[model samples]
Target chain A: MTDEAVPSWEEVAHRYGRTIYNFAYRLTGHRDDALDLSQEVLLRVRKGLRSYQPGSFEGWLWRITRNAFIDETRRRKRRPTVPLPDDDRSPLGVAPGADEALAAMRLDDDIQAALLALPIEFREAVVLCDVVGLTYDEIAAAAGVPVGTVRSRIHRGRSMMRARLS
Target chain B: MTHPGDLLSALLDGELTPEEIGAVSEHLDMCAACRAELEATAAARTALRSLPVLDPPPGLLPGTAPVPRRRMLRPVWGWVAAGAAALALSMGLVLGTAAGPAPMNLDGFSEQHTARILVQPGVQAVRAVVEAP
Candidate 1:
């Protein structure tokens, strides 16, 4: 599409903001950081929309979000380390309170912890595959790696998570 | 028999080939170990799938405010062009200054007199020629 025909920033944000935020949150496990990263990703998307090809919007958004997260991680590494507390409350502050819901949240927390315990490469693969539900090919594209590498990372990551969960 | 754990995850993920599924089924029937592994992997996958979909924290939604497209590249390109212009100007000035004068050639300093002058040791004529004559 031509530059003038590109969608507005608001439209792009409305369509992809939530997905990018969730992907960031799954990677960082911190809500505040996720929010900031999501905004940053959206900002980049807005700036880059003119050049974006007419294709899979989800894949394009995913690629932007992944790069934004990686950049944030690098920036964070250079700053003084401040420990982030584990705050499990939902933003709405309304707990589902169902037995199944609570159990699922608990499992989610466990899985998140297990995922964090992995190397960054493995963690990224697991989050993209299991949490974000991207296909292996999509993950490969987002990560700029080969499909075989993505598959191996996902397989190794899942094995590690299974071991930890069990 | 193929280890059930090997196939169990693929089955749970719906990645099993038809042939692999048939083999896994046959193995599951005879091997209690394989069956248990499949059951555990299935349970874990279900638990994982049940996790709640969380809304992003407040103010993270795209509608809050449109991020102004920061025209970063324009300024960067401007600076690069300015630098190139400055470099070209500086090179022009340097060449202009360096174009001032060619060194004056000594008219009589031919190679034929050099060996005789050098062989006459302590000759003041050689010293005068050597001193930028």
Candidate 2:
């Protein structure tokens, strides 16, 4: 629309498309899911651009991306497709057994696997911070959480990743 | 102060308030455990950020990139149209069979069909009129 109101969808896509794709990929560890999620987010951004005001574009885009991701996750949950290895673990990290630990050591070498192994909330925070390069405040706004929560999640998530990757 | 456990990440992220940063800095100077924790946290941050940036497959946005097979699946409107056509065909067959062979009134059928088309060409319209006496 206007110079100040919102950038056109094409411009947004060109500028942020790769980042969004990578964000989804890191979160889900699947390229197809990433593509679907990216397209869905862009579709939403296109539809929402008209009503957008000129505040924080990063915050706005990421908020849409986060919500779309959650919706997609819920949709998948309802349909119950082939379950991924890391899908069923609780939000808190559970220690792997000796046999599972060896398997994890091998699997954790793949960064995406390690990332997928983190709980969703922690994974989202890490991806948003490191992949999307969002500030803590921006992540908090996008996630609809307090900044402290964002901070805690990122720290804990990265710690878990380090433990796995080590 | 305390361990400043999570504050280590906030500090590395440059997110700590000025006062928090100063306090954490002072704490780190005296605390080897916290310094090591900060380094571990920084390493984790580095590893996470080291992930390769992946480009969205072509055609993530229409007309912006080359179309990929996954995206080349029929558009939504195409599927809708095909579904509508199948429904109309099935309803037509049902109606024809239900009419039976009692001296086929081709003329009456044509007139009614034309009327249905004129009123509403959709399958739902056909069902509404067909279900009517």
Candidate 3:
């Protein structure tokens, strides 16, 4: 492809690539796995953009990321591979409490680890809502569940995180 | 409001109705437990958002930008696609290797001769006759 056409893809990829990569990393807890998942999702996005419906581009892009992660999860199940690390490599940050930065950083790491401990479904919902900042309806669309289900999952997911924090 | 536990989540999300919001606001005003829980959930959400977003490795996008629009094939259709391609390839190979070009004057022969002439040895004889003629 010409250099000119390359930017269009790069634009879309740049817009969502890190988001998908971080989402995948959060889900899989492995940078390499996240990279693979992000690449696959972006490749699918490249091919699937024509079929993408207008409105809710983030939701559409995230749904692709979710599917790629799920596919990788299933494949790993079929042929067991080396276990992924417990700690994720994503750059999760606090709201910048200057005096409390160190404590917040520890809490952030603890929470990130605890998040990975949740079941895949709950983890998926929480990540979509709290991390990806998707609304309930949008998450319902990406997750293929009722909005109420999304709400319930997020609530329960948060409760689980709280339990971990305590 | 009796308790802010259930309403606190929706309240944190700003999903509560105005009336529910008023009730939740009232409860948050008086109830410390619910207030703490609200802060906790909010904290969780914040921590999740703050969780570092790792920079991806270089060259993740190796190809030219998505210039072509192809049909979105569902993952379920992937094997069907591969199987279809395999079947097509198999058919092509069989047809390509097992058959030869049609004879120019095979119609003039009897059915037996036609059938015989289809075989490689008979095809040579037919070729000789055709060449001679």
Q: Output the number of the DockQ-best candidate.
A: 2
Q: Per-residue CA lDDT of candidate 2, range A39-141, in tens?
A: 8999999999988889888888999999999999899889977844545222223466657655544443466777889999999999999888888988999
C-alpha DockQ of every model: 0.18, 0.28, 0.27
Query: How much does each candidate deviate from the true structure in C-alpha RMSD?
Result: 23.8, 15.2, 21.2
For B2-92, candidate 1 gives per-residue lDDT tens digits of 5755456666666567998898889888988777766665654555555556786556664454456543233456456646856977787
- The pairs that clash in candidate 1 are none
C-alpha lDDT of residue B74 in model 2: 45
- TM-score-better candidate, 1 vs 3: 3
Error of 2 at A145 (Å): 0.8
- Model 1 chain A weakest 10-residue run by lDDT: A88-97
Model 3 C-alpha lDDT per residue in residues B56-119, reported as the tens digit of each score? 6666655434445533333456446546756976788534334684444433234334344456
Q: What i-RMS does every model get? A: 3.0, 6.1, 2.5
Model 3 agreement with the true structure over A1-166: per-residue lDDT tens digits: 2322323457788666767777887787777777778888988888887665566666666788788878888898999998656443224443555557667667766876799899889999988877777788888999889877787788778888888877
Q: Cα deviation of A74 in candidate 3 (Å)?
A: 2.6
- Candidate 1 residue-wise lDDT, A1-166, digit = tens: 2333456778777766676777777778787777788889988987888787677766677788888888888988898567588676664344656676566567778977876788888778767777788887788899999876776676566666667888
Error of 2 at A62 (Å): 0.8
On residues B39-90, what C-alpha lDDT tens digit does candidate 2 reach at each position? Answer: 9889888877765455567788556656543332345675566567569777
The per-residue C-alpha lDDT of model 3 at residue A95 equals: 53
